[model samples]
Target: MNALKHSLAGLAAALLLAGCGALPDKPARAALYDFGPGSTPTATAGAAAPRALPMIALAEVDANSRLDGTQLLYRLGYADSNELRPYGQSRWSQPPAQLLRQRLREALSAGHTVLGPEESATIARTEGRLPDTLRVTLEEFSQYFEAPDRSVGLVRVSATLTRSQPGGDKVLAQRSFTARKPAPTQDGPGGVKALAASSDAVVAELVAWVDAPR
Candidate 1:
């Protein structure tokens, strides 16, 4: 009878000790944000919209490069399940084709001429960050996806700009912009947010370049 009582007491003590050693539950992860074309442009109070200046009409880049659209290509996604063939699956934060179309529309909107899907528009000016005009290419596009929040993207563009004059079309400018984004904490949403941030840099630089006196 005494042994049974002792065992019961010991079991109760063990339960209490186990309860004391238990860990608290972790916080639930938040739902990430994923904007379609990244975040929308924000205009500050008293700040005027970008000037719509005259420029050359842009031509569609050739398909020599592995770009999905005009000048947009995304690095492949990571597949957690496949440890061996890690790159077996690719998950794009945004569709490269769609993103390029949106970005091109936005960039051209800043200029004097309107951009459209049709090729009827006269060639006002050609603008891209590729190495060659007729055969521009996007060399490197690196992306990193992280946990708990955010994604970082590094875009390297190389292009050749060709302009059409009375004399004929000629190559104007060619260069690359290595746009980088700091860590974002919103998972899928974070990528778009980061893209918007990165796009801002590109737009600012392009604006200054176009605004500069020829």
Candidate 2:
């Protein structure tokens, strides 16, 4: 009986080893993504240098609660467009708002001296002049799937330009901007590319609008 008991224990140990060996490997870590390095200026052999606009302060970009996390989100427009879903294996390197702010700062710097709110305030106290301020609110940002195979990255935002005055801040202008770019493929990676492209397009429009006569 003791020998039989030992034999049963040995068999149980062998089965346990086999079961452990057959278990599937651990799932892969989620992939991280961000807006790619922004566009580089190319020299036109004889093109005149672009004139810089007046210095401006950019407030932190704000977004709705839906975009407060780093999830790569999407909507199935064909089914329930209002329901947002996140990709399980992909995520943004930073929250969408931070990413947008970084991109905006980079683009705006090309045409003007970009300052933070604090920096602008310090300058105002010392120099007696306040730079114009740009405040952006991200309204909508997600990949929308028209079908299982067709999708586009969509972005929408509102911009407010204001100037400090002796009494209060004066609103210079307010405008809404939106852009959409079709995904090359209907997957997380493709959605990232499409969103980046849409962001660039929107930023280009915003820059033009900001520099336009007000």
Candidate 3:
């Protein structure tokens, strides 16, 4: 009777285990966006025209990644740094791509004529490219840690700005802007936030340069 009872108990435990599914691992949180170029100012309808409007062509921006194997998609986070050591958990948040498109649209519309405007159809038909324009491309963006103390970041951007006829394809004005900012704090989020702010500064400078007089 005792042996029979033990066998029944083992069978009950096995059945219970089979009913429960395996637990899943924790999700990997991503922190992206927070880099370069904030929102653009609104433009009034039928606003007074400036001296000249430039047709601008904006290319895609790029960045380095710490987590993902590919560099195409990356979040705002820390890479191995010389000055600062890793601390705490790695946590990140990224904005949608639509935000970038909106920012670019706003920035360009502020003081320049963006490409593909219905009113500017004549301009495009006349000139192949815009005048006094900028094309921004991000080359190297990463955060460096100062061991046991602080952190810093470097943002390298390349911009091709020019002035020429719509279809002439000539270069009038061009320059490149590089900005570096030291981390405000050692905390992970704080450091990442600072870098993101620096990125915006870089973009703003690029826009201003493109719009400035040659």
Angstrom error at residue 116, model 1: 4.3
Better of 1 and 3 by lDDT: 3
Off by over 4 Å in 2: 1-17, 42-47
* Clashes by residue pair, model 2: none
lDDT of 1 at 52: 58
RMSD of 3: 6.7
Candidate 3 global lDDT: 0.54
- Best lDDT among the predictions, by candidate number: 2
**CA lDDT scores, all candidates in order:** 0.47, 0.93, 0.54
Candidate 1 Cα outliers beyond 4 Å, as residue runs = 1-52, 61-94, 116-137, 145-151, 186-189
Q: Is candidate 1 or candidate 3 better by TM-score?
A: 3
Per-residue lDDT for 89-183 in model 3, tens only?
43333421223334555666766666633334456568543334445555554555545465555556666755546486566655666766777
Clashes (N, CA, C under 3 Å) per candidate: 19, 0, 21
Q: Write the per-residue lDDT of candidate 1 for residues 1-214, one digit (tens) a residue.
A: 9999999999999999899889677766444322254446687899876675654344443332343422222342444412211121233444343444355446656644543323323232353312112223444343454433435655554555565456765766666655778546433444545655665565455445544564
Sort all candidates by lDDT, best to worst.
Answer: 2, 3, 1
